[model samples]
Target: MGKGAVAAVFALLVVLVLAVVVVLITQGSVAIPLGEVVRVLTGRGAESEITRTIVLDARLPKVVAGLLAGAALAVGGTQMQTLFRNPLADPFVLGVSSGAVLGAAVVILGTGGVGWLAGLGVVSRLGVTGAAVAGAAAVLLIALGIARRVGDPVVVLVVGVMLGYLAGAIVDMLVYYTDPDRLQALATFTRGSVRNVTWDELQIISIACAVVLGLSVYLAQPLNALLLGERYASSLGVNVRRVHFLSLASVAVLSGITTAYCGAIGFVGLAAPHLARGLLRTADHRLILPASALIGAAIVLVAEYIAGGNGLTRTSLPLNSVTAFVGAPVILWVLLSGRSRKQAR
Candidate 1:
């Protein structure tokens, strides 16, 4: 496809996603009309105050969180996939989510306060966010080390899975020994609710995701070069080590912040890149990274609508489950098709 055609299609996709989000904001159990939704958004409605509260104070932050988290995860996933040279690679493939969950759980359980991890003042939230970032960085460091030495993407992917499992085991052990009340709080972090995120917490996510995603755009060309092979990239004057560090740092921040707020929103990181690649018909990071971000944002917003946690359904589904529904199939396909194995070779 021509560049203009591809750009047009991507632009349309983003508009469609924004439209869907507006529709979703209006059509909850309360059933605000679309006209009112628009009016409230535009500051011209009879129920302006009520509608504004519902849309802005309540739903808007959640929607923003979903959008940023999804885009962050997708961009991180794309970087990881290219760095590892494996379609199955994703942000969580390095156990970042597991580490963040573990860190949050430790804070919640160790402090014996329900809100210790999530409800502390901004200072405490920042503390937890910092911990999550540190944990994710730890995992990323290990995963990158293994990826460099192993040179097999599938093996590295499996190693990351094992790291995640190990992190999970530790978290489970911590939970098993801790107070049950804290477990309840941990539940929200694990289940992945954009709803639990206050506007205050949203700021942290916004800064982190915005900075990381912006950096991803800056790194895109170098990443594309790196994708050709490390030696070739070095020959072309791309600093392989710097690229690796910056990329890993970006992934760490994106995954860590999102997990801290959204609670390990699985598979958007894993699935969105492939979808973007298929849609754009290219793996060149220049286009794929940003396209994945848009698609990821759309997917999360749509999933949030479907999860019905905003009083849209009698029973709400967890965001993790919703993402799993989309992600697990892609994972199975990669495994069964031997694509992962081929990438390893």
Candidate 2:
């Protein structure tokens, strides 16, 4: 697509994201007015303290968390697709998220007592986040090693799926023997939700995501070269091994921090890049990266709204349930339309 078209698409995505943010902030149980939401967001204080508290405390963190998690996952997914030369590669699909969940679960469930992690404040959160990052990195390394030896995208994809299941199985066993009270903390890890993210946790998420996302900008040209093949990328002095290491590390941090806070959100990583590519009509990482981030953020916000942002329902649905509606169809289209096979070869 032309630069103008790309710019227009990005503009529209930004607008969509902003619109969703407003709607989510305003449509919750108490129904704050748009004017008030805007006022509070702009630092003009709301008419009522309760409205201010609800908007700033209750909703803003969720919105910010969604934006960060979506952007991070989308970028990680884009990188994974290019690195593996597989259309289906993503952190969640490749078991990275599940690994992170397992790591966090160990920390949360292995603690001395119920709510141990929660009671310790930011330090404990950091420990869990670090463990999550370690677990994601472990899975990433294993997957990359296998992918290199196997050298088949389809096989790599299958292996990734198996790894995910293995990690999840470990988590299930842990949950089985754990205290029921600690299980509540593990609940979100499986289902996914941004509702519990606090301003402090957002601090860690924002910093880690910011650093990794910035690094992705540097990796973009190298990634684009890898799309042609590792040999071609190496021919162009891309340092294929270094590029692979950096890309995998980036994916680990992005997926790990997101899963740590947001609870193994699926499909946004898998679906958003495809949507961005479909819209941009190109695989240029420079364009695809930012576009994917915007699209991913919008998708998560919309899903959150549908899942319970409206506050009409007493119980919110698991985010994975809402995201599957988008991801499953994309997976089918890729398989049936031969996109996955084409990319595999």
Global lDDT scores for all candidate models: 0.83, 0.90
Clashing pairs in 1: none
Global lDDT of model 2: 0.90
Per-residue accuracy of model 1 over 271-309 as CA lDDT, tens digit each: 999888778888778888888988888888888888986
Cα lDDT tens digits, model 2, 1-345, are: 788998899999999999999888889789888898889989987799999999889999999999999999999999998988888998999999999998988898985632566767888888788889999999999999999999999999999999999999999999889879778877888999988999999999999999999999999999999888888988999998898889999999998899888999998889999999999999999999999999889989889999985595788998898988988998887777786576789
Error of 1 at 169 (Å): 0.8
State candidate 1's TM-score: 0.93
TM-score of each: 0.93, 0.96
| Model 1: how far residue 280 lies from native, Å | 1.0
Give the winner by lDDT: 2
Worst 10 residues of 1 by lDDT: 111-120
Clashing pairs in 2: none
